[model samples]
Target: MDLQKPAVEPQQPEGCLVVAIRMPVRIVVLVLVVPVRMVWDGLVVVGRFLGDAVLRPLGRALLWLGRVLLVWPLVGLWRYVVVPVGWVLGRLGWVLVVVPVVFLHRYLLAPAGRALVWLARGVGAGLAWAYARVLTPVGHAVLWLVRYLVVVPACWVYEWILAPVGRALAWGARGVGRLLGLLVSGVGVAVYWITRVLLVLPALALWRWVLVPVGRVLAVVAREVGDALGHAWRIAGHLSRAVGRFLATLFRWIFVEPVRWVYRTVLAPLAHVVRDVVLRPAAEAARAVGRTARQALAAARETVRQTRADVRRALFGEPRERDAVPRREPRPLGARTLDSSTTALTKLTKD
Candidate 1:
């Protein structure tokens, strides 16, 4: 029963965390923090003393030299050597420090900067050259082409368009000429036929069939007409005499008596009054107006002449030629007709 009781006994806590918190190693670990801090502080003090002993004197010397002179030789030495050495170290410093850095800057960085500068210059120069040579010339050529091809051709087409009107006019003139020719030919034919029928044939027929009788009748009619004309002449002479006497009586009654009376009584005094009061003043006024108008016209003419002279002086260096009359020769009648027509006329006259 004690064995069974041992097997069934209630256990105390058995976790690894719980067992370690109470162990002896946990106490030793807690005792290690003090010595670790003392060791870390000792190492920091050693590093500070070493840095001050080495760098502080050098920094003070540099500061003293910089205060004394603008040109610091040590600074130059530091820059030329130290910075390059640091850069080499960062790039995994090898056997040759300066040579690799110089080669890298020369072949890579300097060449890259020079190439970028050259490319920018080339682009700028090419753009300027293109603007001056190619682009400007192309723009001028396009403008010239537009003027010559578009504007000039338009003007030429406008001028050529008038050709249609000229052609129409020519066609109209030809049509009118043809119509006139046809009309003239028809009129000439009609006149020729009418002359042949009415004048030539009738004259010939009368001469052949009835010329003697017609001559006798014409002589009798002439004698009768002469007698009738003689009687009419005598009657006309008497009527003219009667009309002249009647007109003379009418003139004496309507005009002559009244004109004579007025001429004696009113005309004499009115003529004197007009001569004194109206005519003399009117003549004087007319003369003054004429003189004023003449003066004004002369002044205007002088002003016009001066203006014309000024215009001529401004426009042309010399005066224009005046009264350039052309001489002409009289044409002879012989030259007025064709030689053939002249020869025919001469032959007809001679014959």
Candidate 2:
């Protein structure tokens, strides 16, 4: 007998087995879902196309027609006939009502107002002149009398009596202050001499001997340390500057130069292309629409002007030529005979 094991297949996980079993269903679902989605998308596309191409245009046309047929006539009637007639009637009413009022105001109320203003100005001027000439002099005289009677006497008392007393008191205070200051100065000088002999001399000696030497040693050590620190700082600064220079150069090469090149080469050209291809055409189309609208407005204006002219001609008859000479009507025979007899009678009377 052969000592060989039978071949065994690897087992699949439950989840994978379930997936495998449902793959056919998934396939069917995908097949159905794709065609259903396509049909639904097709319907949406057709609906959008029909709405854009047919429904929107029809709606716009209906709106335009309604405006032309109904709204335009109403607007024209209001603007032309009703407004003109109302304006004429308003002018007539204004002439009847406002003219008399204006005339009355100009002739009556305006003159009265002017007279009252003139009178008020004259009265004010008279009062001001009277106050300046008469009242001002009286006030000045009263002030002068009060100063001589009351203020001048008070000033004399203060100057002669109170001022001398105050000066004497100030002099006495200055003399006392000077004496006190001299005494304080002598005491301070003595104290200062004592302290210098006892404390200040010893402190100065210690400072000169011990502190000065120690400070000098510390100064030397600090100077050496400062020199070493300065050298290290110089080396660090040089290294940092070199690193910064390298980084700046690397950044310029990696980012700035490429960005600048792209901006110059690609982005600029693309912007120019978009402007030429899209923006220019859109601008041209907008200009064309504007031109069409302007032409339509101009045509409408010309039609309205012609219509107005026709209406005016119908209402007021044709206008006579400005430069034409007037012609006399032919005389009747009886009128001619009467005119001749009158001329003969005039001649006979002159003879």
What do the candidate models score in CA lDDT, each in turn? 0.75, 0.81
The lowest-lDDT stretch of 10 consecutive residues in candidate 1 is 1-10
TM-scores of the models, in the order given: 0.17, 0.31
The regions of model 1 sitting more than 4 angstroms off are 1-214, 268-351
Task: Tell me the tens digit of each residue's lDDT in model 2 across 27-82.
Answer: 54454444444455457767999999999999999999999999999999999999
Candidate 2: C-alpha lDDT: 0.81
List, residue by residue over 47-135, the lDDT tens digit for candidate 1: 89878997788888988888667557667767998889897786775546767888999899998999999999999999998899889
What value does the lDDT take at residue 146 in candidate 2? 99
Off by over 4 Å in 2: 1-216, 321-351
TM-score of 1: 0.17
For TM-score, the strongest prediction is 2
lDDT against true structure, model 1: 0.75
